[model samples]
Target: MCLLLNLFHLDLETLEQSNVDGPYEPMEADATNREHETEQGGTRFSDFIPLDFEEEEAVEEAIRRSLEEETVQVPQESRSIKTLTTEEITGIVKAHSEMVVTEGFRSIIVSRRNVWTSAIRQFRRPRFVESTDMLYVTFASDKNSTEDAEDLGGPRREFFRLLVKAIFQESGAFEESPNGFIPRLSVSHVQNRVYRTIGQMMSTIIVQGGECPALLSSVVLDYLLTGRMFDIRVSPEDVADLELRDSLKTIDQATTDDDLQRAIESCESWRYQIEGLPNPVTMDNKDAFVKNAIIFHVLLQRKSCYDQLAEGLECYELLPLLKENLPLRVLLEMPKVRSDLTADVVATLLKPSYSVLGSNKRPKEELMVVKFRDFLNSVQEREVEECLHGRTLTEAEKTFLRTLNPGHILAFVTGSSRVPAVGFQPSPKLSFVHNENKYLPVAHTCSNELEIFVNSKNLADNDEFEYNFLVALMNGANFSAV
Candidate 1:
């Protein structure tokens, strides 16, 4: 196939201009008459006329000589034609092909005005034509239209070229043909491909580390300009990592002592990239990302500057948003004054606190207080007992619970008052018990509240409500003017 394609490139003009001469040919009419008489049902190009014995012998010998020469030369040409391996071809196609609205049947006229003057003037005229339309179709133009159309064509072509380059960068290929390997050739596809490629490349660079600051800055700028980082498919893991790196750059660029101090204080231990980090610590978690970013900021400055970071302690309340499992095992590993303090620690330190009250001491009332506290703490827990009691929670109540923690269950008994403390213990038995109470009215209410809050917030579908609430809270705190 490739050989035939190459051979097809023979210059017709050059062939016609060749000096080769042969026996005189018959007139077209005579040739046609003979062809009609000997209609052998073959193509006109292939039809041949009878020749004299001597002529036929000469022709056969010439043909044989030509065939022998062709067999020898063809292989040499084939070898020199610059063949690409399958992988190379795949990579090129994957990198470059993008769909564009190159040709369409639409006509539009665009105009621009000088900002200083209120005068409007004609700018450019653009017209789209169907694919089958003749190439170089003339624009039937008035004087103004002609000038405008010509002027527009230059910029339009340039714009398309830039767009194609951008698309190439995004898709990681240099070709624009639809038959190229990259899928989805529309503007949307290009945008998405560019966004994804940028993100992936940035991530790879970060992981590799020691990248040039200028390159890093360019990547960051590209992300900022495109606003593609906020798209749906962007992995939270990538966002968190990039955010930390960008924040570090921001900290490094801090000119004021106050700014440096703020940056140092915001950094936490989680952000440090120690060599040979432990298994659980190295795993990808959104909380881990936030924690690492915070740590990275802190470690970048002098230890004495840490004293200025007392304001950052408030973020400790958002620990629940960092990880879903409550009572988190990490919390349990920490020193505690009392067993009940586990609940308090989770409430005060983490975003959400879980309390299983006994059947006394105003169980429902206490539950509401605890539930409200969870909301304040940013921990959302559904009350299992409430669901078992066959009551439904209102939207307000559900939203209130969502403010506490997401994906947390508060298993309460109708008459229970002394809430049981299960300190960050993970057990199948407990999970079963929790699942059993999931359908209770209290559980239903809390779940409904979370749903309402989540809907109202307009957070991304994959976003955990608790995480968003924490982010909002942190941003508010950080940006707040005292």
Candidate 2:
């Protein structure tokens, strides 16, 4: 055994040294020198010709010709199948290659065409998408599909998921994360999760193809082919909901006049970015989106845009809010929320006191009820330091306060668990002249609210009286000083 091991070691060393010293070297592929290498598992420029990569103009011409040609009927087991020829595959690939897509998409297809083609074979034959002007394909709809039951094919589905993600990565529209890449499908930075799943279906379908498929083609086809959102589904209740929503949309669109159009354009356009999950509103989620949009835009007085949006969503039920008269929906039974201050903002505002100048001797001022603006001004510094505890006012809070104008009732939440639902105040409701005893509770009302002057100058001047004079008349003033 020792002699054999020594002989093998000596032979290995001699082979290594002799190979280096002798006239033994592997030839490298030198495309520039016109000397091609017979290398395995590496692309040579020669391979592109077989893969059907061609000049854009030439490829486009071939595709145009093939598209004009009709397929011959081939019989197979009592069913006619259209088998794609080499020319057809070439035309399909070249046409798709030349189709408009995001920049990085083309290079990925060129590098992984064979793997993609194999993936495509898992589904039915590719179909030309006239809408997007590209080839498209989809999962083979199971003729043997079980109704409303899980298809126990776990590994197959997992493979499809991976294939779809790989395709989406080629588009360069996704953001890299620890888990994987997440698609950024909208400028809104948020989308419906179902729409995202639909997008994934589109991506998966895209890469599983004849030769090469455009990402946009699959995306457009996903919307065109299989959204059950507006469609009447198997579920009767869902069918009714979809039908109702569609009817509402149709009616709303028909009623949209030039004024309404302008209102839509004029409404300060804003999109709500829901936390954690971002998705485009699909037919399945249109109503919910509109409801949320209504609440956000209406309260913020971004009426025209959101109102029109809600209308477009076919939410006829929400149209009344567009008139900017959302009824007194803020329930009185709900608990009144308290102010964050040492004193209650609403209660303090309700107290009766006259605005007065300093007395002759004391030279001071006193009042129970101050103007909301004056109160805010008085407390701003302290509130900014202490009101938010350790944290400062967020952009959302600042924006809310800006839109929550002074005349609007600032309701306080009284129930510890109940959230405050504020009603819009188009015009003030004075309890009496100068609004001496009316205040709405507010949750976390700001200390630097804008001024909304309610008192008439003439009335205010008439109401003003010297405290000393009133005290003297009431037998409380030191009359001897006068």
Q: How far is candidate 2 from the true structure (C-alpha RMSD, Å)?
A: 33.6
Please, what is the whole-model Cα lDDT of each candidate in the order they appear?
0.24, 0.25
Best by lDDT, which number? 2
Query: Ten residues in a row with the worst lDDT in model 2?
Result: 415-424
Candidate 2 wrongly placed segments (more than 4 Å): 1-313, 319-366, 370-375, 381-482
Local distance difference test, candidate 1: 0.24
lDDT of 2 at 319: 22
| Tens digit per residue, CA lDDT, model 1, 1-482 | 32432232233223323412222222455335434533532211100110101112332342233222211111111235444322232223222211211233233232111110110011011121112111121122334443223322222221222222232232221211111111111222122222232233222111111111111111122122222322212112222234454555455556665665565444444333332222232223333443433332222111111211111211212122112222111111111111111133223222222234553323433333344344433342344223223435456445544332221222110000111111111110111112221221121111111111212222222223333333343332211100
lDDT of candidate 2 over 1-482, digit per residue (tens)? 32443254345434434433232111222221212211211211100011122233443343334233322221122124345543444444334324422222110111122333334232222231112232221223235322231222211222333344343432222322221222322212111111222232343322222111122211111112222212211111111123333333432343334433333332222332322111343444434444443323212222222222222222112122212211111110011121222123222232222334454312111221243324333233333223334345566544433332111222221101111111011111112223333222112211211122233331242222211111222231111010
TM-score of each: 0.16, 0.15
Residue 448 lDDT, candidate 2, scale 0-100: 12
What TM-score quantifies how close candidate 2 is to the native fold? 0.15
